[model samples]
Target: MLGFLTARQAGVDDPLRLRRVESTRRVLSLKLNPDRDVDRIHGNGINTIDIEAVEGRYMLSGGADGVIVIYDLENFGGKQQYTCKAVSTVGSRHVHKFSVETVQWYPYDTGMFISSSFDKTMKVWDTETLKVMKVPDRLLPSALSLPLSFSLFSASCVLTFPCHKVPYGHRAEVLSVRWSPRYEHILASASADSQVKVWDVRRASCSLLTLDQHNGDKSKASSEAVNTAHNGRVNGLCFSGDGLYLLTTGTDDRMRLWNSATGENTLVNYGKVCNESRKRLQFTVSRGCSPEFVFVPCGSSVAVYALHTGQLVTMLRGHYNNVDCCEFHPDYQELYSGGKDCNILAWVPVLRASDVEEESDRCGRTALVNPAFQDAWSSDED
Candidate 1:
């Protein structure tokens, strides 16, 4: 970090260097945050979580019991015992016929959110009224709304499109849905049918491209016309932070990366990515770091892998049951994961070696105390 300051002082214009240094420091510091606590709000397994892209002060979480919770992450109490409180909730009796598969805040505003579920529906909610507004069959609405991406399935859906309506579509349950990070009209979906299809929602007639295991090349295994991304259920879909590449994982115990623009399977071979998840397994990518990493929920743990090469880096093992989702907070290089155990664990970077020694030397010979941040810079958030 000191070297980054020195480089800036020398008038060097390398943002990549700064990012790499910062990312490494942040990744190394990651340890379970014990000083703070998130209120135990979910009565069932937590399925999905999303931090608002605006202020980053609030976080939204959805659970298998059809519950939606909003947590205030701000440390207003200014102490270690401070607990993140649930500012609001949308309970099970009101909406969603089944488990909420995903929950996300509007990209540009906190006034709205989008969620999907196992009930074959997706709903857009007005945060102020706690009422949902119906849009087109497309999960998001309008031209600019294209970038406001989140989750896919829901039971009581507003943006309803039946299977028979499309010319060509998957023959099984659409487990996951994601909007292209780069293209406004492009949408991606994974299914129990083991295929990944990209659709241009504007036309809504047919998918632009159907991804294949052989990268559209005709092989003895299958023909080009019949494209299958995986031999098993594809449950997870995520685009890279920069939107250049798309990453997918399946029940086949494999992970594949693809070219988003052309829908060509890059076949990066993330070997044996054990996934027994019948529903969507939410994962995320790290940004501002060269050789960025992909974080995936691997049953009882969150597995960190080198994005390009597919090498397993480390496993985050705080969860007692199968972990369903993990979200990366790039602001402070932190991670928050949810699982079937019904726990939300916060992972923040551990203090530096020198900083630890400094604190320990100051304390005494008895206990080596880990430090907590006070007056932490929440200003850079979002």
Candidate 2:
């Protein structure tokens, strides 16, 4: 890092290249931040958490106690102790009748936010007034799955409506709701009734497509609404960073991938992902990294899997109880997971290249030297 800056001070023309290399190296050296704490504000176990995509400086957390909190993740207090302090919150005094299942900030702005709860209602809020903007009649939580929340922030279509059809929206409780990253008007949902449905919210009267497990088997698709998504309940749903593919996890103990466009099951087999919780199982995919990964909250640990290929990468073990949700920090390649233990764990990639290189030097293994590492040692200045 010093060499990169010194080269700039000395008027080297290629300093940007060195700076980018240094940034990637720092991200690869992620470690658990022992100095920072979550500031234990939630009286009960936290169910869902989201760091605003607009600016990663703040985060929103909703607890099982029907409480909502906004925390300042950055160390702006000027005190070195650096505990994340809650800026504002809506506690038991709020309108939510049951556990607050999920909380999120507007994707493009911070002045507004949304929360979903077990009480069969999802509400919008004005951050300035800290008052309920609109409590819609959505989020009728699943009989077997937890609640879902995503910011479809525009004032137009709130996921406030249940997907049912006779009228064909979700006949059962919508377990998960995610706005399509590619098209702002497109939304996808998973439900307790074992179905994954896509909605082009521009027309609330109908959905774009319904995913069938049979993947075009007329025998099953033709059955009376028997084209269930999973053998059991579909409790989790997430879109790949590019929004080109969708992923779902269910109580059937399996994870499946799909092409978001045509709603075809790509069937990239993620074998037996044990999910016992009847609540929303939140998971996230890594963005802006080579070999993207998916982080899912497993039993007492978070499971890391190679996206698109169902290979198990590693189990991030730390939490002592059932893990419920995990979110990825794309800016730093960090992972934050919350669980029944009432603890939030940060999984980080320890700087291992130096250790591996040392061992390789002792073993006289030339192949261990990656081209990037070899370049780091050989500089134009050298």
Candidate 3:
């Protein structure tokens, strides 16, 4: 009876209820560094963050108050409780006129970065000089419209450097953008007006493909008013490792997958998720697997879902407040989530055998086989 109860508690199916199950487990309170925390820079809440994986060892953050700050993530002074020191700033005097929405590293180089602002511009900046590198006009052609009851909004374009020359395209405020892993020059972007555009970055005019809701092959003009892909504002977008598919989240509290090459909607439903009506959220995909997985920031928790079938696999919960972004580190099989609580939490899967033994030991079951496994289980059971 105790064995049966333990298996059921671990989400065993009816047929396999009695058999010991090896499932992905979660440990909520494992602390990486209780002493060190992300230093706050924004007087208002932070809106976006981008980590540079190369030599500078820096992460860039944009805020609701129109400030951009670069923080050094590495320990320079060899202190136990090292605060993330600000390396440079866009200048408080000449800060963005509107809230900065996104900050991203250049696809090929580490010395350059890009940021998009509600001020209707995407500025490319040289990391060393900390100044605008390229000031190309990439705004959407749509007129600004704000519903009186809700908040004032405008359609904006997202920027990506897939190759040296080919520019990506979007007809609305590009809420999110990502590059394809298989093809270096291929990139994708989602917009508030419910369109996803793909670009080769080498072309002079017209996108390679315009993912419209209507059925047709011809690319529509930027001014054409068409039915949106989602009922609400599209807020988040990501591409799978293979780059064969794309995932999008919206203010309507849903997530959908798409066939990248064909522009066919997979229509997988993640019911009643967070309402990202205003800000952009980040999601990631795990690579080198048969059935790839996607990690989505849904309100206060990160929801892991099967990519192909679009089934909710598990919900990793730890954040005390709404989670704004999540990234999956495939090299370690770990996930990092950051949010309104002003903290980033690292989540790792608990070993299946360990969880089963722990539960069995908690129920006061005796192990007749190996005493070492029993001792190991007893330590964590408490």
* TM-score to native of every candidate shown: 0.84, 0.77, 0.64
Model 1 lDDT, residue 219, Cα: 56
lDDT of 3 by residue, 200-303 (tens): 65554556676654344336324455535566677777888777887878887877787888877766666766765466777777654334567888778888
Q: Under the 3 Å rule for N, CA and C atoms, how many clashes does model 1 have?
A: 8
Q: Write the per-residue lDDT of candidate 1 for residues 1-382, one digit (tens) a residue.
A: 4556666667773656666656744654467788877888998999999988788788889999999888988888778667888899999866588898888887889998887776766678888888888666664346334575555543212223444564366777677778877876777888877888887777735677778778645654453356888889999999998788888899999999998888887867677888999988899998766557788999899888768767665788888999999898887778889999988888887776785444334322221221121111111222
Highest TM-score: which candidate?
1
Please provide, for model 2 over 1-382, each residue's C-alpha lDDT reduced to its tens digit, 9 standing for 90 to 100.
Answer: 4666677778874765565454334333445666667767777777888887777877888888788888887777777456777888778667488888888777668887878777766687898888988534464222112222452212223344444655465556667778777777677878777888887655646677788777988775645655667877788989988989988899999888889999898877778899897878889988764345688888998887767667665577887788888888777667777877777766555557784345335322321432333323333443
Candidate 1 — what's its lDDT?
Answer: 0.76
Report the Cα lDDT for residue 150, model 1: 50
Q: What is the lDDT of residue 142 in candidate 2?
A: 24
Clashing pairs in 3: 155-173, 156-172, 156-173, 156-174, 166-201, 166-202, 167-201
List the RMSD of every prediction in angstroms: 7.8, 6.9, 11.3
Candidate 3 residue-wise lDDT at 207: 65
TM-score winner between 1 and 2, please give it: 1
Global fold similarity of model 3 (TM-score): 0.64
lDDT of each: 0.76, 0.71, 0.60
For candidate 2, the per-residue lDDT at 49 reads: 86
